[model samples]
Target: MSQRYPHPSEPAPEPDSALLGVLAAVIVALIGGVVYGVVGGTFHVEISWAAVALGFFTGYVSGKAGGANPVLQAAAAVFSIGGVYLGELVIAALITSQDLNIALTEVFLSHSGLVGETWDLLFRDKFTVLFFALGAAGAVAGVRKGGAR
Candidate 1:
């Protein structure tokens, strides 16, 4: 059952599907990040724009593959952010030099010779996770109700 005169905003399917695609992109990014972190270590260049691109592309592709409604297809561009986080870890692991760079700040945390805990926060993986989550939210929201034209 398809609509012959589909509105620019309306797809043959529904909006929920679009939302789901966004969610899947985030999940994929998380998994990719985990894999890369476990194998490659945590040194990564920040290509946030790439993540956004991936999020949109993956979401769009996935939605199309699933035969999602057109409305959902638009969401695909937003949902693809999932690939960003996941790709980040995997990319980091694959590209890192496998050296001490990963925890440079942390390694020197204690030997500050009475220095402040500047390095302590540097070693945390918490930021990566948080960023990934943000990416997911941004990508998903961007697709579903993004202010994009």
Candidate 2:
């Protein structure tokens, strides 16, 4: 069988923008964080594996929107960490809301100090640290696998 290739006269596709990749990563991280939070809060259980999935989705979206680059990979890693942190914070807020019989937004926004303290306590766990590292690794792997070369 003969191999087919692009014509010599055809122009190469334009490279994706770094800004777009960053934006996509940020958006994915925020959404994934909320989802992680809702699942943990509703079930009153902490599923650490969700962190890895969140990181993978964030990196995959960023990589698909932007070409493979060192800066994008680094950004994906950082965003993954941020996503995990946000998830923890959200979980704290949700639990507080349930305990205090308050709205979730009120607990999250009005009781920032309490939420911060709870988040800190939760974040100090050894398993949380291990999962965080795993999340970062998943993000980098996703970027490498999904990005355009």
Candidate 3:
């Protein structure tokens, strides 16, 4: 028998560890969230397709990494939700600073109790909650789809 190389059309190899999946999922979700926030804020829009796409990307990366288990899928969804929240908060700070004619640092970093204030601001808008839920649901669905693939 002779040894043979992998066919040119063969799919690429997958990572062997669940840890890789988790890490990739986290990185992807965070980056996606930041992008979503910047674009959303720049356009002065909320609750758009980008948010759902980020969620889906997060879960897909998680599942693609290691054939993610259910626990991993759930964790990815939670992370995706958090990522979206962080992104929204960042954009909110930018928009608020712009409106007040202040630097972003003044709005986000100059206050003594800024964290609590930001949290309050985040919760003040009911739509934030809806966006989070939507992202989370999309993440779960993406994970399921990734597993199927």
Candidate 4:
């Protein structure tokens, strides 16, 4: 057997720390949430592609960074779903307040229950509920496909 190259077997790259992965996913989720809110609100889109993309991106980031840890996977799903829902609530508030000429802060701060009401209203639709489940499933799929562990 002759040597074909200088280094035939290089070590695999180490996986990122779980903490770092989770943190990165969270940061990405925050940005995704903002984008989702803006686009969904502006166009009055109930079944927005942005929301699905956000979930997938969040899971992919977490999986690639964390290497398929159970906690990371679960967190990714939870955070992604929450992020999408939160985005919807924020957008609803912004639009309602803008239409009424009321400060967004005043509506949010003065009426915290409004958030729950908004959630109820938005999720009342069967399609919206289905989308949420789909979003979570997308997150898990992303994690499984992208993660090594």
What TM-score does model 2 achieve against the real structure?
A: 0.86
Deviating ranges (above 4 Å) for candidate 2: 1-14
Reference-based TM-score of each model = 0.37, 0.86, 0.76, 0.78
Query: TM-score of predicted model 3?
Result: 0.76
Please identify which of the two predictions, 1 or 4, would achieve the higher TM-score against the true structure. 4
The lDDT per prediction is 0.44, 0.82, 0.74, 0.74
Clashing pairs in 3: none
Least lDDT summed over 10 consecutive residues: which range in candidate 4? 4-13
lDDT of 1 by residue, 49-119 (tens): 44554444454444533334445444443334444444543444333323324442443353332112321
Across residues 1-149, which tens digit of lDDT does each residue of candidate 4 receive?
A: 88755465765665856786688678877888778877776765655567778888888888888886777777877888877877777777766666667887886898657755765765558777666776677778777766764
Question: Residue by residue across 2-97, what tens digits does model 3's lDDT show?
Answer: 998789999756444667768877998889888887786687566547767888888888887757467657877888887887777667766777
lDDT at 129, model 2: 84
Q: Can you write out model 2's per-residue Cα lDDT over 3-121, one digit (the tens) per residue?
A: 97979988667567788888888999899989988888787666778989988888888888887866778898899888887888888888878888999888867898888887777
Error of 3 at 17 (Å): 2.8
Question: Where does candidate 4 stray beyond 4 Å?
Answer: 1-9
Q: What are the per-model C-alpha RMSD values against the true structure?
A: 9.9, 4.7, 3.3, 4.3
lDDT of candidate model 4 versus the reference: 0.74
**Deviation in angstroms for 39 in model 4?**
0.9
Task: Per model, state how many residue pairs clash.
Answer: 14, 0, 0, 0
